[model samples]
Target: MKLQGVHHVAYRCRDAKETVEFYQKHLDMDFQLAIAENEVPSTGEPDPYMHIFLDAGNGNVLAFFELPSQPQMGRDTNTPEWVQHIAFKLGSMEELLAAKERLVDAGIEVLGPTNHTIFKSIYFFDPNGHRIELAANTDEPGMLQELKRVGPEMLEEWSRTKKAPKTAAWIHGEGEFPGYQG
Candidate 1:
């Protein structure tokens, strides 16, 4: 079956109001709607929560839920902090730089306009401790095609060894592989 597109991606938040305000002030996301219920619609269990949705440009939606009855929100102990992050694509490099400056000026510790060959990104954390990345594409011609060409081999090696395959090292700004420029 063919997939249409992502409806939304949801995550747990410490406070729904804080999350809404943060996204609105920092990322300029529009607070679309909020949902509150005493029971989960799908689970039929009695649990109170406040769910909120924010516009992430181009019809994309980012969502969060605050479950007051549950314990404090925390990330998976087994997962590395940097392993799971929400990445948003900015319109251009100018926009990306501007956003980085804005975040830094707001007293947020921003990481980088780190070059990834195909894109440049800056990373920061939200009030909820969620790592967020804003990226701008700067891929050269045929870069994605070259990466696509190695996809099969990369997956095969990764499946067998459960290790990162070097096939796409070019994308990470290792030795230049001709397709993408850093």
Candidate 2:
């Protein structure tokens, strides 16, 4: 079956109200809907939760679950915090930088407008300690095509060696692409 776009992505939150307020104030997300249930419909377990949905623009929805019955929440220690995050796309570099400034002004510590050749992004954490990223795409005219062309080879080599492949170093202008002069 072919899948359409995501209906929503759900995560645990400490407080439904606080989470909603945080997204609404900081990210300008609209509080779309909320569902409170005494028992999980799928499992029929005796648990109460507040499931909240927020509009994340362009028909995307971000959701959170506040489980009063569950123990205090924490993140996976085994995984690097930076490795697991929800990234959002900003319209442009100016917009991304403006967001970083606004967040900083609000006393939220943020990191980066880190460059990745094709994009630049900033990172921050939500009230739930979930890392969030706002990125603006900055791909040059033919950069994406070149990257896509070598993607398979890069992946195969990386799989075999478990090391970064040099096939796409030109993405960062480390060297020229073979047979093509800039």
Candidate 3:
């Protein structure tokens, strides 16, 4: 079956009200709606929950569940904190920088303006300890096109070697390969 698009992305929050307020204040997400239930609709489990939805713009939605009956919220211990995060795109480099400044002024510790060759981003955590990234596109003309052209080859080489392929090393300002035009 063909999928339309993501309906919503849900994560666990410490508190529903706090989560709503945090997104509203920091990300400017509007509280769209909330769903409270005494039982799981799909599983029929006897659990109470508060599900909240926020407008993440462009027809996308960000949702959270306050599961009071569940155990204390914790992240995966085996995975690095930086590995799992929610990333939102900003319009430009200026917007990314401005967001970083605003988060810093609000007493939130932000990590970067980290350069990913094609984009720049900043990282910070929400009240629920969920890592959040705000990134802006910065790719030069033909940069993305060049990467797309080499993507399949890179993936195949990586699958066989389990090492990063050098096809895209030029993205890091490395010298271009023999046949690469970008």
- By TM-score, the best candidate is 3
Give me the displacement of residue 3 in model 3, in angstroms. 2.1
Q: Write the per-residue lDDT of candidate 1 for residues 47-88, one digit (tens) a residue.
A: 999999999998899999999999998888899998899999
Tens digit per residue, CA lDDT, model 2, 18-121: 99999999999999999999999999999999999999999999999999999999999999999989999999999999999999999999999898878999
TM-score of each: 0.94, 0.94, 0.94
Residue lDDT tens for model 3, 77-104: 9999999999999999999999999889
In model 3, which runs have C-alpha deviations exceeding 4 angstroms? 176-182
* Model 1: CA > 4 A from native: 180-182
lDDT of the candidates, in the order given: 0.92, 0.93, 0.92
TM-score-better candidate, 1 vs 3: 3
